[model samples]
Target: MKVRELREHAKELDFTPQEQVRWLAPRQLARTAVKAVLAAVFAGYSDKREVQEVLDADLLEAPCGQPDAREIWIDYVADVGDGFDATSSVAWTLAEEELLVPRAIEGTDASPAVGDLRLRRGSLLVLGGDEVYPAASATAYEDRMKGPYRAALPKAADPPLMVALPGNHDWYDGLTAFLRMFTQQRPIGGWQTRQTRSYFCVRLPERWWLVGLDSQLGSYFDDPQLRYFEKHLSANLEPGDGVIVCSAEPTWLESVETNADAFNALHWFDRNMIRTRAVPGSKRRVPTHASVRLWLTGDHHHYARYAERLPGDPPGTGVPAPDSRRRQMVTSGMGGAYLAATHRLPAVLPLPPPGSRLREKDPPVAFARMGRTYPDAEESRRLARGIAVPWSGRWLPWRNLGFAKLAAGLHAGLFLLLCFLFALAEGVLRPVDAVRRAGLDDFWGFGAVCLGVAAALFVLGFLGRLLRRILRRLRRRRGAAPPSGPEVATARTALPPSGPAVATLSQALVALAALAITVAIPFPPSWDGWLVLLLCLALAAFLGAFVGSGVFALWVLSAKGGQVAEWQMSGQSIEDHKGFLRLRIAPGGDLTLYPLVLKTICRDWELRDEPSGGKRPVPTGKPAVRLIEDPVVISRGA
Candidate 1:
């Protein structure tokens, strides 16, 4: 049976704690983490693509849409489904804006013949990946992903086409729910779904193609997926054809620290499937090649574009090349997830990092980032301090209630552990008087706990210092510039060498202060004493949310590492800097990309009752949306 239409009788969705997926919540964190592990283990045993192949349900030859349509507009977004405020805000913006005309199309050449460019609502909506947060399920898709979209555009006669690529979160259930929602050729709200497989190829007008690849969890592609692409390209693709490859992850950006499985796979696909024509049963290529013009992805949760190094241009210059059709790697994952730090984006990205498979014919090319980032580097560094520094501007304890609770729980657990250790040391065995007696004897038990925590902090600080040193040496060896940005601005001060040392000392002091608060509670056997313990626990929880989070931030700053920098901002639950891509493929086969970004999501939503048993969200405060930069245009040159 077809899934019932959500728009007809849609119920109002509460965007509060009940509906939103708090990523760091204890239960949610444990469940998703365990499911991720199980999914990985079971993935090799059961491949969904292979199952489709066995059942002969593959959509390789499925009619995607009309291939001869001259002009088209597409809305592409990824990494969605966190909070309703963010998700619904994005959906509302897309739905409300019937036509988007940029304030000024400034980058192109000034010509009277060039008419004003108008971007209408995309007939095709491409959801790049991670449609829901934490995990994928029927309820998750309905509540977190599909429902918001339906409410945004409740009904439409000429509905837009929707296609999706599953990100890591979507694979937690082995893609069971993903296949059900996306591959069924059913209508989701006013949008129509036509893709018959997780991965698909859609030919556009003027010899341009949109290829969505499913690199399942950034691992190897199934044989069927690879063969499907290879066979399709060999049959339909011709020399000089332009291809826009959409993937779930931006492996090139991640290839720096992560294992090269995904990047290597993409490189192989680019070399064999798209770039070169292969001889039968041979690892050779013909001289004729299709132009793999743009690699569009969304794993990083930010907007960044990297263009191939031109012949005479210097590195790290954010200037657009004269030839717009050159290979450009763009990451636009800012659909509706927590904002990621943009300060750590490398000025220049080398295509194949060391240890990854090198390109067979061409040497490793340095791809320079073409323009400004979404939050911009300075703003990202500034935003990070609120999380890294205690009591900073953005460091309100209530920002992430889930993390605050988790922190409190941890501190409470620690208190219990200390009580157990104290009881073990003493001759007391009865559980009835354990807490009352633990602190009655002496301060030794509490003192020991403080010492242990301080010792751990010192150790962590030492390791961070060591890691920083290793990184500095590596940068010197590679002749790369040292890490800059506001977070590291303290290092350039007069006390440069003492930066990490001071940070370590401060962290130890904060830990002692947090522990001392709990130690101050007297252990009288009266009911009043238990009440005092409860008060002390509350204080401890506050300290955990405040100073505990700061300790982690200090460690990240001291380490001065990109991976740690990313972690520092992970739990913030920031609902700003959200973005998506609006792409226009003209009749002449020119691709114009508008990278639109919204600075802050609308928070106050008014719930209005709908006739279809659904509630619609109307924001009192309009979102501040703007283009990230001038539109990126890729022309089909003669």
Candidate 2:
């Protein structure tokens, strides 16, 4: 979640036709109910069996150590994110004073008291979330929290089993940052946390097994959670024991289905009954379970307890609520976040509990401008809302000050800034509509991704050319054969190569095409006049095929280029060296070479002809093939 910090002022919510009718339906003792909940999570969280990490004496010494402080560092939270900005600023302001932050879970004098709830026989304390606000490293765990209330919870409380799943926010830039502070194995002075966010199955003292899914992948890989569920649930459920799935981004919110539309199709909670198949636990070899029992989540920063009856799910709703117990969904994310409420959509009734009517408010209602023939006004616009918004009846002032004002308008704001900058650019020079119809701007965001790929390829080409030249010069100095033929191979001792002669060739080709297109015809202003999309692809491919190939071939094997010997000829002294070139020996003893980087790349000039999968003619003795390197040297040089 990004940050949004404006002072919270009291304003009445807009009354929906139903709300107007239900206003006197009694505030349902909402204040009392909410307090009851806050108390439960705070006090009861400890009854679970989660063991806090005992850090090395040196790890925390440099930062928080005081002469009398204990060497073992435990509870403080660590946030690693880029410092303040619009997003970070919001996170900081909102974070400074509310919600959950691993604060002690004790009882309050007002209501159900903190120490009231109990776990289901045995349960793990699961943190399926982005526990801190804004995720900025500068915002320490304490910067935006109200924990003293929970700190009052006594030590007699039992802690739940600790099973944590990282969220998109937890992974500010990359996951290693948060992992370094909490979950991973860190040396005394390691920079980032070295932990794996793989799914974890926690075993309960009873027979329960709780699975924590790391949904952080939603930002990295498509369908990450779905894929993980598919892979493990088929084999992880147990019969006598119950199953609990905890994740950030509760599946239910997929409730108001956008795009393809299925109320909860994308939420795993919505799909659980379909995922669990009969399988034994990895360690306990028992016919544990074929179906799961519960789903708990946080991320939608309010309390949401949803109940649903999928067509075939068995009823597991505990007693009083027999019809809704089997499938329980809870969003305890009230842990910490600036709270927002959802707009009551016009035609919809409250989805009914355990599905509640609370969440961040809906987006704005845009107005379309009336044509010239009519009154000068705007109305009836089709608008899509954003993540957070003002309560239905409220309107926030859009100002430009750093603290409370928003410089832009409801929507035109972000883009007008760009248009203004462009006008300046053209005013200082000539009109240029590069972003019009025919230019690369016509493509969706894909342009940015493709450009990144092209940049990486170009850099590789540049470095390969540089290294190849260096090797060629070295061979000349050693009175050896110049390096040649797609990077350096074992044969490099007898061969050398010539790097690409034209460095600006691709750019030049693009420039000529753009020049021709600009002068040849008068196209529509809507048409962005440019062909860099296709042109860039062609050049990038050329680079990958030719220049890229040589660069790839040089790193697959641990061998030097030209007169330089990359690997120890035959000795163990080469332990620290990396293999730059790949050595492939086919069934017929033909060898192939490839270069190694993020992935393997084949050299165009050094293709090794190999036998296919079909049978190969061979003698049935001594493994039949003798593969050898050139000039096998002494053990010391291996």
Candidate 3:
């Protein structure tokens, strides 16, 4: 972490309990809600498809020719922010200073800095998704993206080729800024990028192809984009060509409850683009590539890798069997954003089975041994243990006695306030029954009964939390999986799933029920009885809204720190930190992955030795570097 970010974090930690609850929590919630509303409204008004020109465009050509050694260095990062937050900005700067730069001149006697692993000249820089945050406006792009990159990565004499894909955040303004920055033929520093569309295909040496798709706001590909892929695959792609696919977000991770159709977009892309093959003995044309070798995605704000394990395969073979080679799914979304939790994920994720012809190897040891940790893990543990409450500006659900006591106190206070107001109104109205039946003599008793009712209601509210905990414990004891921690208590207290109309009808029925019970209390059929029933209905509505709002607040707090949409697809977490993948494509089409930690000040990179199959020899010495302005190559159907 940078010094400034550390200072900012320290300031946040210095907030008092009262200040956090009274000010910070409300401020953060309001800001987040406003941004969400604006983004949603803008997306609704924007075009829902890729631009026609982009869809019809050809693959972007690099300024330099294929390397003589057939080796390429690619730096892949996703969800990178310019400096949205102090911590994220510092992390992004450090990544550019350390991992994005080339090593200093040799034999200069300059000391090596911590976490210094540089990229070579003429390498390819691929931004997986979400280049900016808050909004995708031109000003935001300039402040958060262009300015930072220009400072950290100065114009090199021979710059690498740059390419990027649009994420949901980038589409907030309908890709206006993203298109201008990436699609327009331009050079950042010495690196040149020529992209005419949001999605593109790049042909590397050794018949390896990189295909990036634009899965925009709706998680669906546009018709033109789909057709472009179909045409490209049918013409240039060969059946045995090694392929790597880049998707904007890991739609495969969206849960059934949220997405309804698990892996819908991914399945479509795989079936239509990557898995399609030519029809034998037919005149109709079709895609030639049978499958892709790797699928890369982001938008979950964490890093995870899952590979199919074939029967009788070697324990650490990272290489996929030819038939199932395209089964590897890697998520590297932790480029720069608030870290997401990795615990409480579903045990078995829904995914397509490996093809019969494909061979699987053992999963990577790093994935097997990855631990779950996040920014709020400690707070969650404390909350679960009753050591803390929900007043830290960290909005995790309150699970213990402290939360119950706090909630009960709040309800009791509100109930007392409402009763006082009702009594004041009754005293002014001077109802005849009050004077006829024992007059003011029973005033103390009536007040006592009302107070008792409030006390009982407060106690009942606390019992709901207790019941939920008991149920969770029972489920665990029976070896049955429990719901997510944040959802467990709320789901128990929440109304059953219903449409808006049904929900309104249910509320009306509840009010009528309260009124009926009040009228049945042996009171005479007079104006007094009707007034009492009306009062009962009013009290019920007040209490209902109060309890409902409290529950909603708790739900909001729980959501603030839990897992994101991508957690469902994380087969296993490698570690609980932000990072991206550094891919090295060898001349023989073999691939090696180096997971680099983005937030670390020292020892930022991890090179796993497991999944040992398809391991390529690491390069030893530097090669002669040169800059060439190659012409754009447009392949057309003959």
How do the predictions measure up, each by TM-score? 0.80, 0.33, 0.57
lDDT of 2 by residue, 411-484 (tens): 12323233233334334322234323223333223334434655677678778978988887887898844323
Q: In TM-score terms, which candidate is top?
A: 1
Give the number of the best model, judged by lDDT: 1
- lDDT assessment of candidate 2: 0.29
Q: Between 1 and 2, whose lDDT is larger?
A: 1
Put down candidate 1 lDDT per residue, 1-638, tens digits, no spaces.
01122233333443222244545556766898899999898987877878775433333321135555788888999998877678877887777546444454223343423444456778778899999987899888887888778768877767787889999899889999999999888888788887778887776667777889887777788888877876776456677788888999888766644443337877878777877666778887674457678889987878888877776775444665646756788999888888877776766665665445564445666677776677778877877776655556445344556666666677666655554554565566632244455453355555666567767876787788789999889878888454343222121232244455555555445544544545444555566745766765677667766676566456655445544455456656677778888888887789888888888887766667778765666677768666777788886542
- Rank by TM-score, highest first: 1, 3, 2
lDDT of 3 by residue, 1-638 (tens): 33233334322322111110111123333654575566567764665454554434776433346444476766677876623232233333333423343233222345544543454433677788888764587766665566445433445555677888988778767788888888876875445676678888877665667888887665567787877776665356666677778988765444322342435666666665665644546755466545566768877665555454445555542433333332456677766554444443332232421111111322111112122222234532333222122353333223222333433344434433433443453563423233223223344455455556655755665577678878879878889443343211121222322223333333333333332333234455465645653554455555444443334333333332223222112211112245556666666666655554533312121111224221111112212211111111111110
> Model 1 clash pairs?
9-612, 10-614
Lowest summed lDDT across 10 adjacent residues in model 2 is found at: 15-24
Q: Give the CA lDDT, 0 to 100, for residue 426 in model 1.
A: 58
Ranking by lDDT: 1, 3, 2
Q: Scored by CA lDDT, what does every candidate get?
A: 0.69, 0.29, 0.48
TM-score of 3: 0.57
